[model samples]
Target chain A: MNYNWNWGILFEEPYFDWLVSGVEWTLFVSAVAWIIAFSLGSIVGVARTVDSVPIRAVATAYVELFRNIPLIVQMFLWFYVVPEMVPDDWGRWMKRDMPFPEATSAIFCLGTYTASRVAEQVRAGIESIPVGQRAAGLAMGLTTVQVYRYLLVPVGYRIIVPPLTSEFLTIFKNSSLALTIGVAELLYQARQIENYTFQGFEAFTSVTLIYLVLTMIVVALMVSVEEKTKIPGYGIQKDK
Target chain B: MIMLGDFDFGVIVTALPYLWDGMQLSLLLTGLAAVGSIFLGTLLALMRLSSIRLFQWIGAIWVNFFRSLPLLLVIFWFYFLVPLIVQGQVDAFESALIGFVLFEAAYFCEIMRSGIQSISRGQAWSGYALGLKYSQTMRYVVLPQAFRNMLPILLTQTIILFQDTSLVFVVGLADFMTSAVTVAQRDSRLVELYVFAALVYFVMCYFASLSVKILQKKMHK
Candidate 1:
C-alpha cells in the first residue's frame, strides 16, 4: 500500500486534452469505420445470398480472408505491407501526405474485419425473412432488384437492429486495436497518461468507464429504435 | 518477380525455431484461457439464472463490466495493477493469461446463458419428477444437453481465442506475433515476416471455423 492516489493529475492541462482528443479519435475511427462496415457488409452479405456464383464466391472469400486474421496483424499489414505493395507515388502519399495514416488504416482494417462479422448478421437477417414475402413480391411482377429493394431490405434491416447494436458496440471495442498502429485513440491516451504520471490504475479506470458510458448510450438508443421499428409477432422481443 | 525479390524464405527458415517457441506459448495461453473461462463462465451463467437476487446481481455486474471494456485495457490493468496488489512481480505471460481468462469469461457467460436457456423446461421438470434436487437436476440432466448444444459455438469462440492470442504482444509477451515482429525487425524484412504470420493465422482459424460449420450442420441433421 505504498502508492499515493493522485486522481488530480487527470484534470491538469495537456493531460485532459490528451483524453479529449483520445475520445474524439476513438469515436471518429469507430463511427467512420462503422459506416464502411455496414455499407460493405450489407453489399457483401446481400451478394452472399444472391444466385450469381462469382459474386457469392468473392464475398465469401473477402469474409474468410479478413475474418480469419487477427485485427492487429491486419492493421500492421495495412500500415506496413500495403504501402510497399502499392505504386511508389501512392506509397509515398500514404506515408507522408495522407492525414492520420494510422487512423485511416485502422479504419480500413477494423471496418473490413468487422464487415465479415456484420455480413454474417446481415445475411442471417435477410435469410430469416419468410421466403413467401420475396416470392410474393416477385410474383407481383416486381424485378428481383426491386423486390429486394422495396420489400426485403427494409424489413431485414429492421429485424437485425438488435444484433446490429451489439455489432456497433463491438466495433467500438475493436477500435482499441488501432492503438497497436499508433492511432492515438482512448486506449493510447490512457497508456500515455500512465507513462507520464505512473497512474495506470486511474487512467485505465476512467477510460474503461468512458467506454462503458459510450456503449450504454448506444444500447439505449438502439433499444428505442428497436421498439419503434418492431413488427408485431415477428422478431424476438421478450415481453415483460 | 519483384514480389519474389522482396521475400526472403531463408529468413523465415532461420527464424523457425524462435517462431516455434512462440507458437507453443500462444497455444498454451489459448488452452489455459479457454478452460479457465469456460469453468468460470458456467458458474456466472448459473448464478445469473439463480433465483436469488443477490447472486444474480453480482453475476450481472461482473458480466456487464468485463463485456463493456476492451481486452487490451483489461490486459493493461492486470499487467500494471496485479503486481501492486500481490506485493510481488507478475510476469507478462501470467498477467496476460489471467486477463484473457477473466475478460473472455464474460463472453462465455453470455453464451452459456443462452445455451442453458435453450434447454426445454420439460427437461428440468422431468428431473424433478425423478426426485432430483435442483443442483442434481442441473448437473445430470440439463447441463449435459446444454454443453452438447454449445460445443460447436464454444469451439468457434476458441477459434476467436486463437486469433486474440496475438494481443499478448501489447503486454510484451513473446507470443507468435511478437516472435514475428522480432524476426521482421532483426532482418529488416517486415513485409515477408508479417505476411507469413498472417497466413499461418488465417490457415489455422479458417480450418477450425470450417470444422465448426461442419459440426453445426451435422448436429442439425
Candidate 2:
C-alpha cells in the first residue's frame, strides 16, 4: 500500500472528458440495445407461442442459437466475421461508412444476443396470461394479430417487466465487451486512461463506480415503472 | 466464404502441446477458485441471513460490489493492485485465480442466498425447537437441504465460470483462449483458430449443462 496514489487525475480536464464520454457511450449503447431487445424479443416470443408449428420451430431455433453462444463470440463475429462476409463493395462501404461503426456493431451484437434471453421471458409472460383472454378475444371475432395487439401485449409486458429489467442490466454489463473491439466505451476508456497514466487503481475504481451508478439508475427506473404498472395481488408481492 | 478446407491441421497438431500446458493452468485455476468461492460465498450467504445488522450489511455490500463490476475489471484490479499492496511478485496465473475467486464469490453468494431463502422459514424454526444451536441448525438442518435444492443452478454457474476462464487471457495467462490466439498469430489464421477455440468452449459448456440436467432428475427422485 506504499505506492503513491493519485486522486487528482480523476478531476483533470482530459480524464474528466474521457469519463463523461465513456458514461455517455455506455448509456447510449444500453438504451439502444434495450429497445432492440424488447421489440425483437416480443416478436420472437409471440412467434414461439403461435399456433403454427413452423413458426414456433423457427423461433425456437433463433433462441437456442443465440442463447447458447457466448456474448463475446457474438460480438467478435459481428465486429469481425460478419463484416468480412459482406460483398467487397459493401464491406468497404461499411468500413468507411461511419465514425463509430465499431460501436454500432457492438450494439447490434449485444442487443441481439440479449434478445434471445428476453424472448424466453416474453414467452413465459405471455403464456402466464390465462388462455381465456385470448379465447375471449377470438370469440369476439378479433383477428389473431388484433388479439395480440389488444390483449396479449399489454398484460404480457407487465408480467415480463421484472425479467426484462434484469435483461437490461445484462445488456449494460455486456456493453463492456465492446472494449475488445476497441470502442472507447466506459471500460475501454478506463483502460486507455490506465495505460496513459499507469494509475490502475484510480482508473479501475472510477470505472467500477461508474458502472455501479449506471446500474443503480437503471434499477431505480425499472422499479418506478414496475410500481406504476403493477397489478394488485399479482407477481412479486411487495414487502410491507 | 473463405473455406476452412485449405487450413492446415498441423497448426493444431503443433499447438496441442501449448494447449495442454495452458489447460493445466486453466483447470487448476478453475478448481481452486471454485472451491474457494463456494466456501466464501456460503459464509457470506449465512452472514446475509444472520440476525445481526452489521453482518447483513457487510454481506450485501460485498455481493453488490463484486457482482456489479465486470469480471475483467475484477481480474485486472487484483492482477495490478495486489502486487502494489503486498509488495511481492505474484505470477499471472495465481493473480488470475485470486481474481476469479473474488469475482465468482459474489455470484455464488447471490445464488446460495436465494437457495437458502427458498426453504420455508419453518424449517429453521423446527431445527430450533429440536434444541439445535443456530450454527448447528444451519449446518445440520438448513444447508443440506439448500445445497441439494441449489445443486443444478450451482452447476449451471460452474459452466458460466468455465467460459469465464477465457477472460483470464486478458491478463496474459496462457489459458485456452490465449493458447489459441498464440497459434493463430503464428499461423495467420485468426478466424479458424478463434472458431476452434469457440468449439472447445461450446463442448465444455454443453457437457456441463447436460450433467446438471441429469443431476437435477436424480435429485428430484
Shift of residue B214 alpha carbon in model 1, Å: 1.4
The first chain of model 2 has a TM-score of 0.94
TM-score of 2: 0.91
Model 2, range B28-49, lDDT digits (tens) per residue? Answer: 7778888888888999999999
* Best candidate according to DockQ: 1
lDDT of 1 by residue, B46-159 (tens): 999999999999899999888889888898899989998898998888989899999999889888998899999999999999999999999999989999999998999898
Task: Write out the backbone clash pairs for model 1.
Answer: none
State the weakest 10-residue window (summed lDDT) of model 1 chain B. B1-10
Cα lDDT tens digits for candidate 2, A115-205? 8888998898888888999999999999999999998888888877887777888788878878877778888888888889988789988
True contacts kept of each: 0.74, 0.29
Single out the weakest 10-residue window by summed lDDT for candidate 2 chain B: B1-10
Best-fitting candidate, scored by TM-score:
1
Least lDDT summed over 10 consecutive residues: which range in candidate 1 chain A?
A231-240
Native-referenced DockQ of model 2: 0.43
lDDT per residue as tens, model 1, A94-145: 9999988989999998888889989988888888899999999989999989
What stretches of model 2 exceed 4 Å from their correct place?
A96-98, A236-240, B4-10
Best by lDDT: 1
Give RMSD (Å) of candidate 1 vs. truth. Answer: 1.7
